[model samples]
Target: MNFDDLRTGSAVHQFPGVLLGHNVRIFHPHLVNLYGCAIGDDSRIGTFVEVQKGAVIGARCKVSSHSFICEGVHIDDEVFIGHGVMFTNDARPRATNDDGSPQSEADWKVELTRVKRRASIGSNATVVCGVTIGEGALVGAGAVVTRDVPDFSIVAGVPARVIGDTRQPVSKAELTA
Candidate 1:
C-alpha cells in the first residue's frame, strides 16, 4: 500500500515510510525501528526489532523481540522469527574503501536472503546472506546458518547442519520406551 493508506497520527508515530498491510500489529511501536519495509496482513512485530529498508515480511508471520531484519531479506508467509535473530545482507562488510575513505551504500553489494513459507527460525539465530531457507524448515536456537536448508529439515548448531526431517514422525513404541 501507499503512504497515504498508512495508519495515521498516534497509531504510527514511530513507523515512517512503512507499507503496512491490514491488521498488521507492531508491539511497542516506540521500541522498534521499522523503515521503508512492507509488512503483510496479520503479521506481528515484537519490541526492539529493526526491520530495515527493502525488507519484506509476509502475511501471518511473527517476528519476536530484539530481531534485526536487514535489507534485501524476504520472509515468506507463515514464517516464525524468534527473539534476537539476526539477518545479514552483506557478505563482505568493510568500514572504509581502498582510499581509506568511509564506505557508502554503493561501496558494497547487498546479498539477498529468502526464508521460504512455513520456516521457523529459533531464538538467537544468525542467517547469513544469499541463502534460501526452504519451506517448513526448522532452524534451531543459536544456529549460524551459512547455507541453504532443505525443506522440512531440522537444523542446529553453528554453520547449521541438518539433524532430522520433520516429516519423519517418531514411532509410538519409541516414545513409550
Candidate 2:
C-alpha cells in the first residue's frame, strides 16, 4: 500500500495506518509494521527499512538500506543511519503477551530512544533502547551501543564509549564529496 495516501502526523501512525509528514520519501518494498509512526520532511527510508510503530524520524534524515528503526525511536533531523543499522526500543521482549495474544504496546517496557541531530551511525551498528545518542555524535561501524553518546562524541566498540571528540575541523577527505 502507498503511504502517501494515508499519511498523518503526530508520533504514532499505525500499520495499515497513516504516515504523514512533509516530503516523506519511502523506497519501495519497505516493510513497515505500522502503528504510531511519524516522519518529517525530506526524510528517506531506504529499501528494506522497517519502521515500526511509534517511530519518529525527523526532517532531512537518511535511513539507509536494510536498517530497522524499531518502535519508540525518535530520530532527529539530518541523521544518517547507515546500512544495516538497527534500533531497538524494548528492553524486554516476549514472543507473546498474556491472553495468548502477540505482544503489543502493553507487553514490553517501552523506553524512549532518541537520536539527536546530525548524528551518524555507521553501517551494521546496533543501538539498544533507552539510550540517547546526543547531537552530532558519531558511532563507528559494527558498534553495539548500550550507553549514552554525548554530543559531538565519537564512539567505537561494544557498549560504546567516548573515544574522541568529533567537533574538530573536517579534513579534505571528509569534506570532499
Candidate 3:
C-alpha cells in the first residue's frame, strides 16, 4: 500500500526508511526500512526480507523470509526470492571509499541488480550485481553466482554454473526448490 497508509502493526510490521507503493501487502513478521524504494502492488515481501534504498520490486512477486535486496536492485513482476537469498552490488567493495573515508551514500558505486520476470533465486544463494538472471532461470541455494544465467536454466556452485534446466526439475537436476 501507499507510504502514508503504513502503520505500526504486528502482522504487517514495517520499520522506518521504507518506501512502499499502493496496494502492497507485507505478510507477517516482514520488516523493511523505507528509503525511497519503489514496490508495486500485490507483491509479498515475507519475513526477514530486507529491501534497501533505490530498489524497485515489481508487483505479484514472492520474496521469501531472510532475503536481502540491496540498493540498485531491480526485480520484475512474478519473480521469487527464496529464503536467505542475497544480492551484492559491489564487485570489489572496500571498508571505505577510494578517498579512505568511511563508507557513505556518496561512496556507493551505484551498481545494478536486475532480476527479470519469472526468475527464481533459490534459498541461500548469492547473486553478484551488474549481472542479469534471465527470465525463468533458477539459481540454486548456496550457489555463488558470478556470471549471467541463461533463461530457464539451473545453476548451483561456488561460482554458479548452469548445470541443468529448471523446466525439467525431475530430470537429472532433481534438486530441492
- Cα lDDT of model 3 by residue, 116-168, tens digit: 88999989999998899988998888998888998888888889988887677
**What's the TM-score of every candidate structure?**
0.89, 0.78, 0.81
Off by over 4 Å in 3: 1-22, 169-177
By lDDT, the candidates rank as 1, 2, 3
Candidate 2 similarity to native, TM-score: 0.78
Per-model RMSD to reference: 3.9, 6.1, 4.2
Candidate achieving higher TM-score, 1 or 3:
1
Supply the global lDDT for candidate 3. Answer: 0.77
Residues 25-69 of candidate 2: C-alpha lDDT, one tens digit per residue: 666633534456777777777877788777888878898888888
lDDT by residue (tens digit), candidate 1, 27-52: 98888999888887788999999999
CA lDDT, candidate 1, residue 126: 100
Best by TM-score: 1
Candidate with better lDDT, 2 vs 3: 2
Model 2 C-alpha RMSD vs. true structure (Å) is 6.1
Local distance difference test scores for all models: 0.88, 0.79, 0.77
Better of 1 and 2 by TM-score: 1
Model 1, residue 131: distance off in Å is: 0.4
